[model samples]
Target: MKNTIIIIISILLLVFIFSGCGPEKKKVAVLIYDMEDPFIKGVSEYLKAFDQKSYDITYYDSQKSQIVQNKIAEKLYKEGVDLLVINPVERLSSYIFVKKSLQEEIPIIFFNREPLKEDLEYFEDVYYVGTDARESGMMQAKLISEGLGNDTENLGGFDKNGDHIIQCVILKGEQGHQDAEERTKSVIEGLKGEGFKVEVLHTKVANWNETKAYRAMHEIMSEFGEDIELLISNNDAMAIGASKYLMDNGYFGMEVDGVVTDIPFRIVGIDGLEEAKLLTKKGYMYGTIINDGKSMAEAIMQLSEYILENDEEKLQYELVDNKYILISYKYHSNE
Candidate 1:
């Protein structure tokens, strides 16, 4: 009977040891700007597929509202989440969410849309993962310059009119958006540096919505007709929208006596998404600058691991002051 009791106690001790040795599942909450944005959609998909061995992830969609984002963030904090990942709907309004999370001592990783610098400085545990907007803009101009045959005087082939000036239309994203403003200004500056005398026919704000881009492009086409030699969009969605309108109106890919006479106009965009890459491969889009979503995901995971382990030395990348993990841009060719 004593020997039986010893065996039972040993079994109980073994059970207790195993139960205590099991790793605690870290609770991670992710807040997205909107699942509607394809780039953010891709990132959210990746985050969802993250290894369950390390984290239990819960996702929340802000639906592009600051109030909704703040409310969801507060709820996540109250739930005792170990980490918070956010892609703010409106960057300028991200302070509310960041402040709340920081005050609660929860580590936050801000992806895609960047919060203000002051918000990040409030806590060392905060980080931002995104690319430099100016790089994409410069890349778009390089593609345009290359398409013009790299001849400063000739403006590549963009100067379809013999007038020696390139007439271009800008399909801008959101009006007050940081990406839109930087891309718009940098592309023009880059083009000027490439020795092209550019004449801006019109600049229209499409709010980064495809439907709005379609409507705006249609009107611009009606006014400019074939006189518009180039089209520069802040993102691939807008470029695709404008391209769709042009294709539907028989302005592009016209057949002349059984021969496909494609329009000579070049269209450049940012964000080398899969759809955009496919379009580029089909010669519909001129080219695009890659916004690396995978890199952003990797960075977020690395930062989260650093926070959880409390070992900055184990981090894959040292968090730079200001902590901007700017992903590099790759130019996707339409050729």
Candidate 2:
């Protein structure tokens, strides 16, 4: 009887050990700057759709406030998350989060918005996955030049006044955002470098908001009117808003077989959103640069897995300087 009892006890202990050895999900905390931003929304959706079997993911929205993001970062650190993925509210404040990650010993991946190079180099565990903002800006200029027939001296019919210079109105993003600043500066410089003369009629800060862009467009049109030959927006949302304003005011007239037959001026933007693609197809907007959010999410997940496993050999994406993963931008146009 003693031998039989010993056998039963040993078998129960073996079963318990095996059951507890099943693969455990890693906890990941994803903090988004703002869910309302269309580009950020797309990235978050892609992250959410990832397979949940390997990761227990929780998300927090910062509502476009840096203070709120800092609080959430603190809470998640205390809660002991294995990984923290942040799309920061402000790029300048990235050091705060980096310091927090170092103190808490949590690995961090920043996407969409990039952190300062110094902050990213502050820790070995810090990683960034994003596109080069300057590349997006250059592509925007290429699209505009192509639409104007690629001739600096004789900008074709779209020139409106045959002045050999593109009269443009720019709809800028946030005041101090890195991407906004880079995109705004690079596009203009890119145009000049390509030997195209560009006269910026007006530049307004639309804050990457569609409604604000619509209002800005209204004001711009009220002043510049037909003298404006081109519209350049920092993002697709603003471009779409400007297009809407144009349509409402009889700028784009009479759709013939689902295509706008009369488009007054060429409008271009970054971020190849679906709505922007539809607008481009219908001739309301000219072109856009593809931001490629889906691939960014995949890269972030792969990096997370690599960090969690402590295996650099398994990393699929090439890390530039062991710090950044840059996704390339592609230009998309109707032609």
Candidate 3:
């Protein structure tokens, strides 16, 4: 009995020692460009929910400034972070981040806003997680064109002006943003491919802000008025902004039954946020393409684990060609 009691005490002591001396928890630094963005906010929440508890994640909001982002990154490195997940303020300005990652031998997962492909190819320790911006645009066009009923010849519903051409006003995101450029260009191209001759009344760069989008829509309404048949935005925030303005001006309104009615102009946007989905369900917005925040968060976490653990099999399954893990968008329509 004495020997068994001694054995139990020894086992308890060993457990305490090992628990106290186990390897330090890995630290992950996540730098987001703007925390106020709805889709990004959703992604952050998902990341928190899906964390595996093996590592500690710290999120820093750069507030849409490259200098701030750089400083935050430096601070994180000084604090001994094991990995970085960056949604850059400027995609092309990733050189500084890349250099730091190389110097410190830390892995980086560039999600959402992507750096150039050439820049990505420059390092083996870096990866990008995002959907093809053009795909969102294609889906937007598909929703719009399909709603018009005719695939090619008749552009009846969309060409609300009774002319053969559809008058469109584009609410673009940040001016040099890659996603903005691609989404804007591809949507136009997709429309043309569907035989809808587009007359772009104006292209307003709203910097992805709902307030800016509201102001831009107000100004555009002053100039173009009802001549604009379709409002296409790079994100749902801008669409919401436009919708609010339309609601104030009698172009859109909620009926007695709580359904969104009186939507005269067909409106569309990307990034199917919950609020946007709710609006779509109410028949306010025509449609939106859902950016899968859950999938993105899962991929980021999986890749982070693979990097810190050096698990090549996990890495292989997480990425395609050891570089990009592109998520696909799902379409949601209220039409």
Best candidate, lDDT: 2
Residues 151-220, model 1: lDDT tens digits:
7665666666778888999999888888899999999999898888889999999877767888898789
Candidate 3: stretches off by over 4 Å = 1-18, 151-154, 253-256, 313-318
Tell me the tens digit of each residue's lDDT in model 2 across 1-335: 99999999999999999988877788999999999999889988887776455888888999999999999988888878999999999998889989988888888999989999999989889999999999999989989889878878777587788888989999999988899999999999999988999999999999999999998887898899789888999999999999999988898879888789988789999988999999999889989999998888888888888888888875788999988999998889999
Q: Count clashes in each candidate, considering only residues at least 3 apart in sequence or on different chains.
A: 2, 0, 0
Instruction: Sort all candidates by TM-score, best to worst.
Output: 2, 3, 1
RMSD, one per candidate, in order: 3.1, 2.3, 3.1
Give the Cα error of residue 101 in candidate 3, in Å.
1.2
- Kindly give the stretch of ten consecutive residues in candidate 3 with the minimal lDDT sum: 150-159
| Number of the top TM-score candidate | 2
Relative to the true structure, candidate 3 reaches a TM of 0.91
Error of 3 at 27 (Å): 1.3
Instruction: Write down the TM-score for model 1.
Output: 0.89
The global C-alpha lDDT for each of the candidates, from Candidate 1 onward, is 0.81, 0.90, 0.85
**How many residue pairs of model 2 clash at the backbone?**
0
**Candidate 2, position 132, lDDT:** 94
